[model samples]
Target chain A: MTYCVGIRLNAGLVFLSDSRTNAGMDHISTYRKMIIYEKTDDRFMVLLSAGNLSISQSVRELLQVEKIDGHEEEGKSGEPITIWNATSMFDAARVLGATVRRVFEQDGRALKQAGIDFNASFIFGGQIKGEAMRMFLVYSAGNFIEATGETCYYQVGESKYGKPILDRVITPATPLNQAAKCALVSMDSTLKSNLSVGLPLDLLVYREGEFSSNDIVCIDDKNPYFKMIHETWGQRLHEVFQGIDDPRWDGGDSAHPMMVRSARYDTMRKITHPGERIV
Target chain B: MTYCVGIRLNAGLVFLSDSRTNAGMDHISTYRKMIIYEKTDDRFMVLLSAGNLSISQSVRELLQVEKIDGHEEEGKSGEPITIWNATSMFDAARVLGATVRRVFEQDGRALKQAGIDFNASFIFGGQIKGEAMRMFLVYSAGNFIEATGETCYYQVGESKYGKPILDRVITPATPLNQAAKCALVSMDSTLKSNLSVGLPLDLLVYREGEFSSNDIVCIDDKNPYFKMIHETWGQRLHEVFQGIDDPRWDGGDSAHPMMVRSARYDTMRKITHPGERIV
Candidate 1:
């Protein structure tokens, strides 16, 4: 079990990952799930992974030097291109997909025999020297889908618990720091609801064209901002919830009445007696 | 997919369920998931179910006359007894479990042969005369576990998206109306994030000693309070989130600084070059 998120916005990219992993409740452990690839002025990419630890680790290790058939533009007719030398983020993602496929080919049979699925997925995103910042969700089968305006973020593992706020607040135009804030808040909700997702967190914010960044931090329980987020979000949320008027069952002249007159009410179904029919 | 929730509070019980069901995206349909059994002042119970619709529907049909051997005291050594004759909520729950087992015995093999799971679960709770109110989560195997003060609530199907709110707000002492308000809010979050859970909700709130309640309503997309909740909650949540200070990347002299010094930072993992090793 794990939780990781990647957001591509107009301002930059925000990546967050939790470190908790568990084979069972008794086997809880810490393992970082974020990786950064930096070539200074050339390219900047980040990978956030979730699923079988072994498969993801193999994919990450192979992704750096994994080669693919390059188009003739790179050099010779069939030069091998790696993530380090690829000219575009799409090419890098292809190399990553190939890496995943290789690992699956090697481990898929044995894992299936042992009753384990070849489960591995990743959020791979960043900027190449010339192209705009891009992001993708790479599936276990080595296929991938890019993030777009309607869905500018990708999350894997324990994602549903943290999705509502992201749905309500995120857009392509959200500012860099604010999206980072949103990512942390989303992670906070996840950490609160799931025992298998936890801190210290690995958070990295990459500016749109920076090819690299210093905005990386490892957040343990004591970090001031995360602690404030954990405390204030819940308390303010409680205050906000209290601010909303309670449902008025009386059907009086209230501003917000829980019971409204509607024809659809008659269409509702309920079985009230032993001999009652469903109809 | 479906969403059903039941809460046991000191004030009474609150049950909420959505009516959406889907075998696949192409086969989405509406099906009520809550059942009410009441004999006025004598006893009252509600069933909120989720899982394979067929199994649940069968279990519900069988539960009424589905009897088990009554204890010797009930009559001549082994007279029939059912939920209608059960005195304690615990005994009533046992009757419900037995009804589930009967359905399993009838359909389990056929479902397994077709590769469909014998899946079904229920949030069954209510007050029976001569006993305190109780709630149980009935699983597929017909085994059940009672809700306690610490847990206070149970949710089935598409549950995680709606759970954080419940985790933050619910308790045994929470007032009945507020708990109802909280339940609707939880459902609202689930609706926003999941297309499989749709409009027209079934909500019922029973008071501690009332035995039965008139405070039942079927809320559709047009309901005003729900519309208010759907709008105000997201807006207010955004406001609350905005009030929380954004993470300070610069480590400025602010009230909340995101980055603080910690020894664990040195142990953080990152890959800066193609040849970099994990250790």
Candidate 2:
């Protein structure tokens, strides 16, 4: 299991992934899940993957050299085009989908015979020359979907544990650093709630048109920003919880009362003595 | 889909459930999932269920008169006793189990024929004298497990969306009202993160040793405590998020730094040009 997130904001894209993987409670190990593919002054792409370790590894390997027939293959000429040469982000996604299919062609049958599903999910996003930053969620079946404003981000694997904060905070207009913060906050929630995802995180922040920068870090337990986030978020959340008044059942006597007068329903039925039952 | 939670504490037990039910995203309706069976001064039990609605309803209906053999059926005098006369919580649980089995016998076959698994989960908790209070999680096959100090709560259906807060706040020593508050907060998180769960919540809080009380209410959109929670939690969380400074990449002049030299690994490999790739 893993947790990886990719956010495409107006300013740029934020990519983050945990470095832990587990076969079970006893067999846990560190594995980085973020990959960067950049052509300075040309294109910048980041891939965050989650799912079967074997399949993800294969997909990553194939993506480096795989070519989509329509977009990357030679047009009656002897030219090799790949993620390195795709003209648009959509073309890049097509190359990614082809890579996934290549992996499936190689290992999908064997995994199926062994009673395992060839499951994999990816968040691929970046910027290409002359186009706005684009992001996509690619699935195991060699299919993909682009992220739009209505759904401006994509998450994979142990996603639900970290989803609430992202839902509350992220927007297309979020600034680069703020989106990065939101991603880390989301990752912190996942690390707290799930055992399969652990620290030594991989983080990358891309500015919309920069094509590349050195904003990449591998965060372990000792990383200062992550440490601050883990400590402060929990303590502050508790403080906020405490600051909110507890429910008061005394009805009219309290300022923030728990009981409200409503006609839709009454108190739960109460039974007294052996023969009593609420119907 | 549904979300229901029940917690047993030394102070008492708290049960909260949402009423939304859905066959699919397009076919959604409201169906209450909590049932109360109490005999003041003799016994009290509450059932919070999640799973196939029809099976739960059948189990609820059958529990009224369901009985188990070879178990010490409480209160009810006879070879086979029902929930109406169960004297002990254990006996009550057996009757509940019997009720579950009855439902399984009636619908398990037909549902399985349609490829629908006979899935149902229930949290049954309450008190009967001559013994301390107890809570049990009843399963689909009529088997059950009790809640101990280490795990003093149970949740069913769309649960993960609401679990982090509960994991952070709940323990056996938590006060009854505070536990109730925690349950509501958990519910609020679920509501915000999921559309399948909605308002008009049913909440019940029972005090230990007291057979029952009227501390139950249906919370609608306009409920004051809920409104305060909805507003304060979101606002306070935002404030807390804002209080934490965004990651300082250079760490040269920051009060708390993000990047630091580490012994385990260097920075991740970055692809600087189109022809390069990390291996």
Encode model 1's per-residue lDDT on B120-151: one tens digit a residue: 99999999887889999999999999999999
Q: What tens-digit string does per-residue lDDT give for candidate 2 at A9-68?
A: 988889999988887899888888988888868899999999999899888877877876
Q: What is the TM-score of chain B alone in each candidate?
A: 0.95, 0.91
The top-ranked prediction according to TM-score is 1
Tell me how far the alpha carbon of residue B235 in candidate 2 is from the true structure, in angstroms, after superposition: 1.0
Proportion of true inter-chain contacts also present in candidate 2: 0.63
lDDT of 2 at A158: 91
Where model 2 places Cα greater than 4 Å from the true spot, the runs are A71-81, A261-274, A277-279, B72-78, B261-279
Which regions in candidate 1 have their CA more than 4 angstroms from the true location? Answer: A72-76, A261-265, A272-279, B73-76, B261-265, B274-279
Q: In candidate 2, which residue pairs get closer than 3 Å at backbone N, Cα or C atoms, i.e. clash?
A: A271-B38, A272-B40, A273-B39, A273-B40, B74-B87, B75-B87, B76-B85
> What is the Å distance of residue B234 in model 1 from its true position?
0.6
Interface RMSD of each: 2.4, 2.9
Q: What C-alpha lDDT does candidate 2 achieve relative to the native structure?
A: 0.84
Clashing pairs in 1: none
For candidate 2, write residues B148-218 as lDDT tens digits.
99999999888887788887888999888888888988888889989999877988888988877567788
Worst 10 residues of 1 chain A by lDDT: A270-279
Calculate model 2's interface RMSD in Å. Answer: 2.9
